[model samples]
Target: MMASSDPAVIQTRALSKRYRTVAALTDCTITVPEGRISALIGPNGAGKTTLLRLLAGLARPTGGDIAVLGTAPRPDPAFLAGIGFLAQEIPLYRRMSAADHIRIGAHLNARWDGTSVRQRLEGLGIPLGQAVGTLSGGQRAQLALALTLAKRPRLLLLDEPVAALDPLARRQFLAHLAEAAAGGGLTVLLSSHLLSDLERICDHLVLLAGSRVQLCGDVDALLAEHQILVGPRKDTTAIERDHTLVHAVRTPRQTTLLIRRNGPVIDPAFETADVSLEELVLGYMGQHADGPSPAHLSAIGGDQ
Candidate 1:
């Protein structure tokens, strides 16, 4: 891609971190378009957190390469300068107050905007005089966020940033991400098991399940491609074999199906409705299930 189209962040072919036998990520090729908010979501061990770590350059990729702002990681000044990372459990000096932490943030980030830092936290109603160790989980997350935004990053990689918060607090934190991206063209890639929270903030999705990418694309496009059809139960054969079955449920009276079809459904017995992003994602993840199902979600990783 030309520099104009070149994203500030990219992973040409990033594969990394196998724990003796299991591969965390295998030949993961992807990119983050400049200034867009992308969500990397997956189940507990789906390698979502692992990918976030690699992107932040906290751990070396076991096999392939990754680039941030056109540079490599770990003390790569330009890359480090342009990225602001809020790890899963952001570390803080136990004794430091919110105000003191911002001071430390100012020290590391070359472009630290002190006034902006204070204003952001104050705007959020986070008391600067209180010590980091004294803050609640949600408050601490906000504090970490305050430190990160204070850096004026070109890219922000957040991992379950609001996982510890209540519903209301979650809203407040996500709003911060939205404002940051809109006002300054900040590219953000966040990972969360909280699909609802992510759904509200992300424009793009990267769904990971079973340690590999299942789907990747724009949120609206995926929802448009797959569909849910509700109607009478058939012998599994008569329901319409035209579409690749993504998910199927059989009740005594009727059946609901999720499918990926090349064209329109011609089945007269079925009533088709557009699948929500959540349903589209669940269909992909449930493709191989023998009987039961766990939770499912969507990103934009593309056909499992």
Candidate 2:
């Protein structure tokens, strides 16, 4: 478990990114502490990729600031050596064999650990002599991950790395990731739409909707701060005055409200229940479908 006092490995303030007429991200701010695997999730066109690109220093932000490893990202050798980024496409030479790629990595990366990475691939029964193009999708993904891990970066940023893998492959990929993270000294920011998979390996969360941050916090802290309230259908003016209403659904006789507690719900009218991570994420995403108000867009915990 990561403690609250852990130093931040990633921070952004009022970050904005625009591509011609479209705004990819707007006034986004977030913080990720060291030694955490954070899930970055949002709907399509919500700027998840843009954020990852900016953090990796592949693209510059149009406005605001971003810091990774306590300094602004740059293309210098030291900065590049400290972080490993695997884009969604999983860039690799299709014509090259796994052994050929390993040799290339050894020459290109100063900290390359080809021996360990090759051993890992061999243990998985991934043939070293086979051309990468002929390998299965899972094999290619694993190969890419192994190469990235070979660099031994302190921070790893992945953009939908496993979206194309089947269920068993995804499970295997996540298991490998979990094993790597268990060694400590590594921080990962993974962008994926699979909420259940994220829940299994991530302890931190950064949720984006409407091209802005909707929620950002430690998983346990966020869950502890939110709850579901069920009661008879009626005007919620009084309730609204006290809590941050994340989502509300009303039926003929009853109303269910998911809320971020401003304080304890002492009102006898509502019965409280625990909120699951999937339910919490869905509520925030649904609430922001029509554009979230300023009041609802605040970061839940950590630096804003």
Candidate 3:
């Protein structure tokens, strides 16, 4: 892999994949800026994992292109060294201690930092002598993360790293990851069904649906461009036509609308309500949630 000075750590163009009659991804394009956490979200089978695997070099795209750190996901040792991935399913050695698995990371990774790993593990208070198979689900997840972080990869590809963690653990893990992104210039692409979990940490959000990107942008800026208003049901028709209705609820005499519009404070018919990041993401995925439920809510090891 050839290194460049560009800050764009991950970039893709028209990326797609298909399996027989199923189209898993179609014309997917996204850019993850350097030094920030980017959340890749979508409804079940919206191609979140498919796109992630393409970037991680674990699976080949059926069509289209992908580049990590300005080079194709080829078998370049240098390129591989620049990235560390924690799969949705735990990938640690079942018989090994947390410490042993970390040793593997040190042996295999080009940029592995022993001191960093020790410090992080010590900070987390993860017992190193126990076998990974014996630990609880959340502990195992932290062990997996420890192995990845010890490598000190420039680009971190995590597929729901915190899904199995408890609320406190989840918060702690993401807080550290966010700090790493802020201080180490680490670029992360994480996919999860829990939008609220990422709300406070991630800088950018990407929503995928129907095998394509529905929206992608800075979280704060994106919300600013969209607003929610609630008022008499009589205003529904006008609100739907003039602004994008992300989601809406109707009561006997009042209707609530989450619209993508900005400008002026001059709406006498409806009252505006600020939407949280969770509401914003749920708004986009709500359209597809009615079809077959969501494949996203299923945990990583369910029925495995």
The numbered model that scores best in lDDT is: 2
Q: In model 3, what lDDT does residue 242 have?
A: 56
Which has the better lDDT: candidate 1, or candidate 2? Answer: 2
Which consecutive 10 residues in model 1 have the weakest lDDT in total? 292-301
Error of 1 at 245 (Å): 2.9
Question: On residues 1-304, what C-alpha lDDT tens digit does candidate 2 reach at each position?
Answer: 3248989999999999999999999999889999999999998788999999999999999999999998898988888888989999988999999999999989888888999788989999999999999999999999999988889999999999889899898999989888988999999999987677678999999998768888888999999989999999888878876887888889999999989888889878899999999999999888878455554554222223
Tens-place lDDT per residue, model 3, 1-304, is: 1133446788887788897889999887777767768898876678888888888888888888888988888666787888878898877888998778767877877777767766776788877888889988777776676677777788989987888789988877887777677766588889886777777788888788777776676677777877878788775655554555566768998887777773544569888878787878777677545442233222101211
Ranking by TM-score: 2, 1, 3
Please list the C-alpha lDDT of all candidates, in the order they appear.
0.75, 0.88, 0.75
Question: What lDDT is reached at residue 12 by model 3?
Answer: 83
True lDDT of residue 79, candidate 2: 89
Q: Give the TM-score (vs. native) of candidate 2.
A: 0.95
TM-score between model 3 and native: 0.84
For model 3, state the Cα shift of residue 140 in Å: 2.2
Cα error, candidate 3, residue 146 (Å): 2.1
Reference-based TM-score of each model:
0.86, 0.95, 0.84
